[model samples]
Target: MTAITLGHLRDALHAGCASAVARVLDAYEVEVDFVDADADELPGMLDNGEIDLLVSAWLPRDAGFVQHGMRLIGLLYRPVYVWASTKPLGPIDTLTSEQVGRFITVSQDAPRLKAALATLPNLAGTPVETCDEEVLYERVSAAAEAGEALVAMIAQPHALFHTDMLHVLEDAQERLGGEMEARMMVRETVAACADSDMLDELSEMTLGNKVMSALDYTIQVEGVDPEDAAEAWQRGRLVPR
Candidate 1:
């Protein structure tokens, strides 16, 4: 039996996809191992043939991995970023560029923030403080409590976890007219060595719609385990190749 190695960022979104992919491979009687990897390390690992596949979030066009000789097989989801505040953010349209620029915080290399800045060129020079994901919510919430008119641009699913303390800017994506997507990638060598038919079936099942639905159900629905949700989705929606 061939042992296939898979890697993904350690997050709820990627975890769901990893689960679904694992189940799909199981049907083909393939041995699979899962690795939780940091985003920065994925490119290097893939380049060195450390993993057969990497399930990663969609990146900007000029992202390093795009030129790293990896093949993007399919999209996992189209994720948006929200400008969340601890206090109410008034009508997005009415807010002046300067008013919206009090301060904006984001994670390192966040595609949503990149898009937002591109849309609001006036905010290009606005203060952008970077923070690790674990403390991102706390930093934004603290800024709000300090009476600072600030917003944190964060991934949509992560915003849900901070809903108790933050009010998501309702039309942030509408204003930006762009959203980041998640995609599954594999090295060229891995792609050539693997089963193309199975890959195609997995890719078809890995569309943004199916993965996002699975994510929402696992993350928002009551009492559902992520692994179980992914397994159920695979059994119900996927046609074996």
Candidate 2:
């Protein structure tokens, strides 16, 4: 069996997506070993051939990570950053003064959200409270239960999108960084040695936003192991090739 090293960021979502790719590689009799590292380090590892493939790369935002010899072999999905609320919100510019005051986001997303807000003159002065992921979920859940309005900047394909009460607000202007494509990147050596058919299949594979969100919910909310969740999805949803 041919062996390959697959690299990914250390997060449940990334782990689950990587597992799905591993499952696909298994069909080609490829043995996959997973290597988890921070976003900053993974690109250099790929450049050094320490890893054969990266399960995903968020383009434009992480475009700086693309090294000289890296090849993007697949686009897994395109997920957009959204402003979600317990109730429907008017357009970004039309947001009520009260809505603008109630904006919140996770600490990790604060910088991006702030940058987006800065582009909207109407919302430049809006206060955005930052909290940890757990606290953000807790506050959103509480607001949903109380039928109160709370606006938040959340990236899609997230477990939070599983909440039935949460609605993505209209952003026709796409001020919130637009769609980010999650793509698979391979080292030049790996692409040269890999089976062409398997590589083509990988390039054609598509897991849209809905399926990605369900994968996230399964691993993050339902507490399923990423490998198990991926296997179930692979068996149930993915077409046999």
Best by TM-score: 2
Model 2 accuracy (lDDT, Cα): 0.80
Give residue 199's error in model 1 in angstroms: 1.2
Please give, for residues 1-241, the per-residue lDDT of candidate 1 as tens digits: 3778888877656666787777778888888888877777866776777877777646663266554667877766676655765567774544555665454555664655666666666455766777775556567667766877676766655533423666666663475445776777777776777787778976876445434544544544333555776766666642222
- Clashing residue pairs in candidate 2 are none
Q: Per-prediction TM-score, please?
A: 0.65, 0.89
In candidate 1, clashing pairs total 1
Worst 10 residues of 2 by lDDT: 232-241
